[model samples]
Structures are given as C-alpha cells and as structure tokens.
Target: MSLATLWALGSVGDRLRVAYRLLSKDLDMQIETTAVIRNVQKGTASGDLTTHGLEFDQLDPAQQMAMKAFVFDRQDDALEWSHGAR
Candidate 1:
C-alpha cells in the first residue's frame, strides 16, 4: 500500500475529487482521483491556507499507473539533486 498526502492552502471537504497536472514528457499529464480529508493542522506558514492531510480513497487502474510514474519520476529527481549526480 502507498500513502498519499496533500496539503492544501485552503479548506477541502471531507471527500472530493481532484485533478492535478504533473511534469509529463512532451505532453501535459493530468491525473484525477478522489480523496478524503483525514486530518487538518497548521504548517510552517501564517495564512488562510490550513494544511489538510488527504488520503486517496479511490483511483482507477490507469490513474494508478500515472500516479506511480509521477511518484517515481519525482523520486529520481530528488535522488539526483541531493547526490549531485545526474
């Protein structure tokens, strides 16, 4: 199982559908999924946006693949950036 957490700068309902874009090669990739607000708290900021911990509740097969690709891509970037190795 994978964990999904989203910190919104605003209020989100208990359950909602969200669509977001990721860095896709040669194309704009947008993934949609349904999530539920599990917890809300303040982060390192002073603004109207309250951090909300979101848990992904539903995702189709295609969506899962896209998300996995996105996560892996991001992880690779982090590793390369941190280790100064491209």
Candidate 2:
C-alpha cells in the first residue's frame, strides 16, 4: 500500500475530508497530495468525503471504496491489523 492509502485507511469519521501537505520525504516515495473522497450511508446516517486543493484522481480505487464502505457501515474496526503473531 502507498502512503496515501495508509492515510486514507487511518481516517475515521462518517464523513471524511483530508488535506495533505506532501513533504520532500513523501515525494521521494512518489506520493502526492491532491484530493480524496469518502462517502457512507447507514440507517439514518450518511457521510461524505472531500479534500481541498487536491485532485480526486490522486486517490486509489480500493482506498476510495474502502472509505465509502467504512462510512456506510459506520465501522472503524473492520480492518484492524495485529502487531504480533495471532
């Protein structure tokens, strides 16, 4: 996964909007900050994702879908990774 993807995965909220400042280190990794969207709907709750000063195309499809699904389901523990052996 890319840094952008990691950042998106770490995001938590019904509606998510992120603004990332790409530093030199990020550029070294070929990561760029543009725009991201996360939309979710569950029961009587609905959320949206938006980013400022960023291009939407910068986000990966999987990351986008993951955000949407997470928001829609109102779940934040869907993809937890254990540090040690299971």
Q: Which candidate is the best by lDDT?
A: 1
Question: Worst 10-residue stretch by lDDT in candidate 2?
Answer: 22-31
Give each model a TM-score: 0.65, 0.24
Total clashes for model 1: 1
What does candidate 2's lDDT look like per residue over 1-86, in tens digits? 12222123423233234454322311212233344334322223234332222235456765565445545443333333333334
Instruction: Give the local distance difference test score of model 1.
Output: 0.65
Clashing pairs in 1: 9-49
lDDT of 2 at 86: 45
Cα lDDT of model 1 by residue, 1-86, tens digit? 22234445345456767777766553357767777767667556555445567778877787777778877877777897899665
In model 2, the clashing pairs are: 34-54, 34-55, 35-55, 38-49, 40-72, 41-72
